[model samples]
Target: MRLGWYSDLNKQEKRTYWACFGGFTLDSMDSTIYALMMPVLMTVLALSKSDAGLLGSVSLIGSAIGGWGAGMLADRYGRIKVMQATVLWVATFTCMAGFCNGFWSFLPVRFLQGIGYGGEAVVGAVLISEAIKPALRGRVAASVQSGYAVGYAISLTVMPVVFAFLPEDIAWRAFFAIGLLPALLIWFIRRLVPESEAFQQVSKQSRKIDLRVIFGGEHRRITLISTILASGIFGAAYIMITWLPTYMRTVLNLPIASTSGYLAVNIIGSLIGPFVYGLISDYISRGRAFMLFLICQTLVVSVYMFAPVNMTVVLALGLLLGGFQGGLASGLPLAFSELYPTQIRANGAGFCTSFGRGFGSIMPAAVGFASTEMSLPVAMGIFAVSSYLIAFIAAMCLPNATGVDLSDHPASVVNEPSPTEAALKKTPAVFR
Candidate 1:
């Protein structure tokens, strides 16, 4: 009975939903493995705090470029092909990092890995959004993004077990080597996933990649606002993930084991958040739901920064803050797809998300630098405040997407040009 029900659902939805979820899950797993190894790597390499931060920044820089590049490729080629290639690219580079002899060798390898990481989000999100039914798009997209939280939890659980038996020098290598496992998934993805029908229908009509289209009259304001909004979310998220453990250890005086436990709890909260927000967005307006989450995040993060240091309070705050912020992962993908037409959908989403990735690259180091002069809480408090402010601005500027079917929008507006339509107009068919 259960199998029958799932089969029915699968037929009704599309393979792209499962494909994006699986790809994102592996992407998250690969990224978190490196994050978990950061402290160990720092100690083994004798890296200065600044040098360690720079390594992270380089990866984000790589991802920003990858994101923009992948989006363009997806529009020119197809989403499935681009996604499969990105997974393979990251997995190959990540495995190579296992063989690095020193920090210098590892730095370049990690930057290359970032390129794959950057491309995954843009490709995966557009693929899923375009393939699924309009009514189910928000929920399904949220579920896909939620796969990241599950991947992070799996890394946290497995890393400790891997470390227990292995020495430090070899353990990092083992983690990197495990990253290669995702490469095998490319074969499955290639076999199972198909190009989006919507993309195919639209691409037949328009073959050109027009830069002027994105910055032209209708899209310019929305594009700029989306970029700013993504920057705020990415900046806050990267800084929190990178520096939160350090803050817990240095400021709260928690042992490494206890801090790991707190992080595990936070990740659990993150796992739940996207699904909850997805359901809520389906019932309420996406914009309203986003604004509510941001407002709650503003209050919760401030309390988290300045609250008294009891274990119970800290754990509660960590869970709430993590959950609220993680909701952004779900919201942005759906919002971006709805904001643009198919022709420019991939590019707009890619550019906005990647631009944010570039800005986000500096946030962790900025937090670390600020901490040297100001109190840890003070520096983090500023970050929390700025995030909420920007989120507020984004919410205000964002157009309401509630209950609108993207297919109803004009093909030229969204970038979907039918082959017949192109032939009628004597233009070449675009890549589908």
Candidate 2:
């Protein structure tokens, strides 16, 4: 099966896969670096827990807007063009964030940076899903999503050295400065990856992006269900991610070095989770695989939070939790993409994922508030358990769209011309 899948991909398709993988890797590193810096930033900026959570929430809000806007644009323009732009936009804003002098200054920079971060994910997922054949879609998309773990690992490994060597004030800034590295990916994408053929085929026939397309038609239920699904998954994920570093250092009284060591084990599990999820998803079905992982996530997170605090025990549970979370996430884009046809796939998938970020963004702040009443772990566990349960229900409600083809338009037709597309058509033939 592996050989068949590998042999089926042409040179262009293979390049597209690697491009999406690389783009997502850099995007994950740039975005997740903030989580690592949060503990330090809190001290340096005199930020209350609420303030820290607000920053995260605001950035996620920006991601939602960016995701929604980018998805619409990807439908009107081409995916590759919008994707390249998002990469540059995020890298530039992230570098600006490195220079911010205070809380107010950093807020806008991070928010702007999040726009590109959000858009890149949408375009990359849509591009790859459209480019590959349906039979390989589950495994390939999951593999691409695995880049998040790789990026997280890269940040986890580098952060310690950067912090240890540099002064505290400069160390945090330096981490943000490293966001500039992903700007180089634009050059790689420009040269290596082609636009999705699926998009190209439907380009002339495509209707302009309208809210009615996804939200007012037969697609509305799927859209609503998808958003709820994304929200639950994202909420649970953000709670763990936004607070894990702080929880380790503050509540557990772990030193910086020890925190890094524990996170390293978790990252290892994260790296392995996607492949396991991919195989399971390919063999069974996407929704079933997601449901299975969500169950594991609920269990592992409880153990990680409440179990005895021995170093070995913590490491083992952390690894398991990471695996469960990572595997659960791997199914999201596949399920979303499989549900929508090519014409609106970008919009549908992007909105669902981005909207999830918007809803999930609240958990960090909620956790911050809840921590004052109870221990951080208990607070996180409460939210996580609820979120996972909601996500499980949503997963069950969704259709089992494991290997559905997305290369064609939907059966229904509404080919209204977009202002954006009309403007694009006005460009000279040479420019086009």
Clashes of each: 6, 0
lDDT of 1 at 106: 78
Count of clashing pairs, candidate 2: 0
- Residue 16 accuracy (lDDT) in model 2: 90
**Over the full model, what C-alpha lDDT does candidate 2 score relative to the true structure?**
0.80
Best by lDDT: 2
- The list of candidate 2 runs beyond 4 A from truth reads 1-8, 408-432
Per residue, candidate 2 scores C-alpha lDDT tens digits across 18-127 of 88888888888888888898999889888878778878878887888888789889987988898888988887887787888778987898788878888988888888
In angstroms, give how far residue 320 of model 2 lies from its true place: 1.5
Off by over 4 Å in 1: 1-14, 101-103, 253-256, 408-432
